[model samples]
Target: MIKLRPQPLRGRPTVSVVVPCYNYGRFLPDCVSGVLGQEEVEVDVVIVDDASPDGSSVVARRLAAADQRVRLIAHETNRGHIATYNEGLAVAEGEFVVLLSADDLLSPGSLARSVALLQAHPEVGMVYGFSPTFADRPPTPRTTARSWSIWPGLEWIEQMCRRMSNPVSTPEVVMRGSLMREFVGYDKRLPHAADLLLWLRAATRGPIGRINGADQAFYRKHGANMHVEMFAGVYTDIAERRRTFDILFDEDSACFPDGHQLREVALRSLAREALVTMCQAEKLGQVGDEPHDKLVALAAEMCPPERDPRLWRAYERTQTRSRSGRGPVVPRTVGRAMADLGGRIRWRRWRRTGLMSAVGSL
Candidate 1:
């Protein structure tokens, strides 16, 4: 038998665009126009502003008032990302909903491709497309599979827990509006990984679908991206995600409990470690002990003995640089030591002193 590819859907499909906005005044116009531009398919814009001070609420209201297709929800007080998305999900009426960040812009007709997959495979819980970076500055280029041959039976929870990559990026994901409520929407506590957590369960529980396409959404990178803050303990968001996954999977005991994302969790931890290390190393020049040791403890949590390099020798390399009246030159040994030193710090002032573990060993 010849393996033939799935054909695209033929008719206009209903697609709802849910734009979760905050104080994103600059690029939001692109987000709105992107949704409205998909003329071939019916689209709805559900904009929820989490009490942004820069007048995003006013913008949302104006868009709602101007276009019958757009609906605006205003939060009197500042609600977080999860609550804002929940507000939009509660009232969205389209057959499928796509959450578009205010800072993101969609490639033309991206939604129609997603709608085509969902329309063809009625059994699938969610259909997601690829979203490569679209803003002019270098966007993070993500390459992943476009289609999956999902069978009628399997346990999604266990699979998600065991494998690290959830595959469904927040921007590329388009979901059946009804299924959003089938689960508890998004867990408000896991705001850091809320979208991933929800999509993980959705993809696993039902037959998952994917659309490989060149056109994707634009994820704007700037000083304000939440991921940068992840180093300051946001990446520990894995902890929150772990907590949520355990409880949710437990409630349905028939599904196995996942201790962690297993693969991605450690990779994410390493990334957070690198970020915390760089931030801490930078802070050592500008600030004092409290922030310093906070990173010290963070470094300990992040870098283990098998991974960390020797910081004492990294300082020695600095001494070498100082001797030559120039900046530090990291020697080969010292450089390796500098590369990994998270696991070798003291937890408390009273319990021990600055970095006792690797001194004698190094």
Candidate 2:
């Protein structure tokens, strides 16, 4: 469907939130209510039911009926999440767009806070904030956004490449409608890391904004979450993230001059990740399930021997044996200590900022 952008509202900005559901009927009410109850924004929710087996369509229809701000688009056949996302985004007529998963939720003032940043900084095309993850019930957010952080598009891309991770989760992102529509949709190829790639693409258009000192959304953690289901193991996650970068470089390398160097940075980061995972597996004697040899090979392939000798030597030491040729008992101790230090650093970062510095096998 061709979207006709609606005229700007008189006072509040109109935000079109696309809540995509697939067998998450139980969580639909909470998800949609959060979008509708957002303060200081005229919010319209487009609930796209992707032909779920659970009675999600019924719930969506009921939501649409209950409020004029809510609309339902039920697919007869399961076209998958990528298609569903594009279909819903294609119909967004509001000033801003949010692709919120049905299982997640927005914090009380998330949309309004994001809108404020976007409205103030015309250079920023995308705005995201901290999202705290929860299991059963979400914790109430106490603070409001105290300040905003804005980064140039290229700088943001560089940061992403250096870290080789996604900072913004799905629900935490609020995209400028025009910039969001610049891309066709979430790439069908990247079922695991489409959101990461999409955010990078958005950053190419303009600067990125972040809301600080407060939470933006609630990221629900469960058995059936997409990341948990798709990336069940370490190897799968590392490979998919590598694929995401490949597509990113292929599509938007021209946008940034240092794209080649950034690609190498991302590759090395991922390679180091594999090596780290290999060490952890060995120390825990979990090598059987984790595939130590494959991890070593992946690390070698990504970083290469000449790229970084220290990292390569770490990999080699993990494979070395004692004088009796038994196992890497001595090296395992060192690896375990290194792993513990890395975990502590990551924990500190996560505690300081609600965002995870690294995600999915990192």
Q: Which candidate comes out best when scored by TM-score? A: 2
How far is 281's C-alpha from truth in model 2 (Å)?
Answer: 2.3
Distance from true position, residue 67, model 2, in Å?
0.4
List TM-score per model, in order: 0.66, 0.87
RMSD of each: 10.4, 5.7
**Count: clashes, candidate 2:** 0
Worst 10-residue lDDT window for candidate 1 reads 349-358
Q: Model 2 over residues 1-362: C-alpha lDDT tens digits?
A: 01112122236989999999999999999999988999889999999999999999999999899999999999999999999999999999989999999999999988888888787777789988788889889998845676677778887877777676677777989998998788877988988888888888988888888777778899998757532242237787788889988888887878968778889998998888777666556554455566656767887888898989987776666566422367655466675565567666765675444335653231
| Alpha-carbon RMSD, candidate 2 | 5.7
Quote model 2's TM-score. Answer: 0.87
- Tens-place lDDT per residue, model 1, 56-100, is 888777778888988788788997888888888877778888888
C-alpha local distance difference test of each model: 0.59, 0.79
